[model samples]
Target: MTPAARVSAAIALLDDILQGAPAEKALTVWARNNRYAGSGDRAAIRDQVYSALRRLRSAAWAGGAGDAPTGRALMLGLLRQEGEDVDAIFTDARFAPVPLNDAERQMPGTAPEPVALDCPEWLEADLRASLGEDFVPVMTTLRDRAPITLRVNLRKSDPAHAAALLAEEGIATTPNPRAETALSVTDGARRVANSAVYRDGLVELQDAGSQALAQAVPVADDARVLDYCAGGGGKTLALAARVSAQFIAHDAIPARLRDLPDRARRAGVEVRVSDAPAQAGFDVVVADVPCSGSGAWRRQPQAKWDLTPDRLAELTALQSEILDDAARCTAPGGVLAYMTCALLDAENAAQIRAFATRHPNWTVTETRTSRPDADGDGFFLALLRAPAQTA
Candidate 1:
């Protein structure tokens, strides 16, 4: 497809997304119907759509309105692309859009403020509270595409050997400092899903920060560990790799763990699935509950725009409930691990504070947080231990 044609495709997909279709769903439907579009064409169109979404507010402002639709966003992105004025492309000709009116032609194209730089206006204060003075820089980092990272299955192979195997398949990776087994795919990331390394389960896609978070949990050999909210079991797999533990995984939505068995098999790890609580108490109970995913807006920009104050409150309540329940599963003097991908203070520090207040017997033993500027998705982990019996 021509560059102009790709722009047209992005505009159409954006329209579908604006009309209530999810961005991924619209892109998938478009690709399915337009089988003639090659891989490169599809990738280019996707980049255009996501780039516009990441800077939606700025694109709207540059297009002369705060509510510019898909076509206007496309035109503004194109304007930034070739440094051409919007008038040059919207000529109302065949295979092109209608010409801009006199007002659009004269529209003021100014850059947006820091809040409008990446996230919506309503989330500004929350972001500030979460990130403090580094909010702008963190949000700026989230405006671009995230690097593709892979966690080597230490149970199967060491990082060096995995990197060598990936290199044999023409994929280059660099060891990530933030995660012991993480490899940042420096090149050939597009082919990773089909590569031999991925097929053999030598590596699995996961953020470095998540790997670090799992590593921070001190698990003993033969220790009984429970992943209480093990959605997709990524953290479960990571934890299993870290120790020879009696791993148990469960989730409120059992369907999320359906593929976990297969994933565990592929990764050559044992993880038992149970809907009911384990009869044996756990040495460590990990509650990686759901959250706003604020730290990962770069990978899923739509989420940032979709979050609301009320929804946030509901999530905090849920996090508290999960923490309370997970604490019960931890043996006396055992660790209760609370985790979330949200960078908001309400979800991270505030949630921890609330948990500590309600359960005074549990003392926070350790806390760790990762920021977008720190080479991984934003995350928070708190290790709380129940008080030992007094003599």
Candidate 2:
């Protein structure tokens, strides 16, 4: 498809997304119906759709849509922001967008702080407070694609070995500074999944920050660990890759773990699926509880707009409850790793502080954080040591 045609396709997909249909769902439906659009066309359109979403508010403002948003306006705004030739793409050609009128051709005024940052107005204050002097930079960084990172299963292969194997398959990689096991894919990323290295479990797709979080876990060589809220078991596999511990995975919604067993097999790790994880006596308990996913908005931009204050509050409440349960599962002298993919203090440090207040016996050990930056997505890890004896 021509570049102009791709822009037109993006506009239609954006309209479906704007009307409350999920971004993924709309894209899927469009692909199924427009099967004539080749793989490259679909990928290009997807990039355009996500890019616009990442800059939704600012793009709308650029397109002169102050209160109401439209697909055409968003595309125009995105082009304006990127300093692209709007006339070239909106040519009214057979498969192109209609040409811009005098109103659209005119430049728009400056956008509000939240709009310019593509953050929801209601969330602006909290994010600002959470990020402090780095708020602007962090939010601005979220307006682009996240790096495609892979976690080398150290049990099966090291980063150097993984890089060599990936290079043999045409995928270029650089070791991630955030975690020793992580590699940032520089080229041929689309082929990584089908590459020999990945198929044989030398590496698995994971964010560098997440790999760092797994590395932060303090465990004994023969420790018994429970991933209390192991959604899809990424953390579980990560932990197992680093240690020869007895690992167990569980989630409140059991169906979320349907693929974990296969993932474990591929990674050469044995992670027991547990339906009775609550009756735990674990040396390490990892609680990667759910959150607003604010730090990962770059990868899932639609969620950035979907999150509401109420939903955030509910998440914090749920996080606290999960912390309590995870704490219970931590054996005496064991470590409880509390973590989140949120940059918001309400979900990270503040939650840990509240948990400390609720459970006086659990002692906070160490905390590490990385706000979304050049290295990786925002992640928080806090280790708490249980009392030497269970009282």
Candidate 3:
């Protein structure tokens, strides 16, 4: 498909998304219906749709479609923002958007801070408070795509070895400093999943920040670690890859861990899947609780606009409950690692403080934070030590 055709397709998908269809759903349905659109066309259209969502407010303002941003306006705004030839793209050519009206041709003025930053209006205050001086920079970074990172399964290969193996399969990677085993995919990322290296589990797709969180957890030789609230077992696999440990994964909804067994087998790791994890006394218990997912908005920008204050409040309450439950499973003096991908303090440092307050005996050992960067998404990890047992 031509570039103009891709933009037109993105506009229609954006309209569907604007009218309440989920972005992925709209994109998938469009692809399925238009079987003529090749892989390249689908990828290009998807990129355009996601980029528009990431800059929704800014695009609306630029296109002078305040309050109600139509798909055409958003595409025009995105084109202008990227310094594209707006007139040429919106010409009378086949599959092209209609020529811009006089009103759209008018120069767009600078937008206010929140709109310029593409931040949700309701979230500006809390985001500013949580991010302080770095708010602008952090939010700016989130406007683009996130880097693709892979966690090398130490059980199968080391970072350098994995990079070499991947390079042979047309996937280029550079070692990521966020974690010892992380490799940031520099090129051929689309082929990574299907590459032999990934299929054989020499590398697994995981955020570098997440790999760092798993790396920071203290694991003794032959220790028993329970990944409490382990959804899809990403962190559970990361942890198991690092050491020879008896890893058990359990989720509140048992179905979330349905694929963990196969994933573990591919990575050559032993992981016991338990529905209840009824017993405690785990040497290390990781509670990677869910949040508003603000930190990784570059990957799922819709969440930035969809999140509500009430939903955030509910998440904080849920995080607190998960922390308590995970704490109970940790052995005396064992590690209780609290984690979140949220940029808000309410979910990160604030949650850690609340956990410490609730469990006065537990010690807040160490805390690490990573803002979204070229290497990884924003993440927070707080290592809390359970109180020693009494005879």
- lDDT of all predictions: 0.83, 0.91, 0.91
Per candidate, the number of residue pairs that clash is 0, 0, 0
Clashing pairs in 3: none
User: lDDT tens digits, residues 1-391, model 1?
Assistant: 7666777778788777777778899899999999999999999889888877777776666666566556566456546543765555566666666677776665565565652565677888777787888788888888777778999999889999999999999999999989899999999998899998998889999999889999899899878999999999999999998788999999999999999999999998999999997453688999999999888888888788777888988998899888888987888788988999888888888988998888877899899988875468888999998767411
Q: Which candidate wins on TM-score? A: 2
Per-residue CA lDDT of model 3 for 135-190, tens digit only, reads 99999998899999999999999999999999999999998988899999999999
Q: After superposition, how far is residue 311 of candidate 3 from its true place, in Å?
A: 0.5
The Cα error of candidate 3 at residue 182, in Å, is 1.1
Looking at candidate 2, the ten consecutive residues that score lowest on lDDT are 105-114
Task: Give the TM-score of each candidate.
Answer: 0.94, 0.98, 0.97
Q: Write the per-residue lDDT of candidate 2 for residues 1-391, one digit (tens) a residue.
A: 8999999999999998988999999999999999999999999999999999999999999998875889999999998888899899999998999998988877878887878888889888888899999899999999989999999998888889889989989999998999999999999999987898998888999999999999888877899999999999999999999879999999999999999999899999999998888785799999999999988999999999889888998999999999999988988999999999999999999998998898888899999889998778999899999999988
Which lDDT value does model 3 have at 205? 96
Candidate 2 TM-score, true structure as reference: 0.98
**Model 1 clash pairs?**
none
**Root-mean-square deviation of every model:** 2.2, 1.1, 1.4
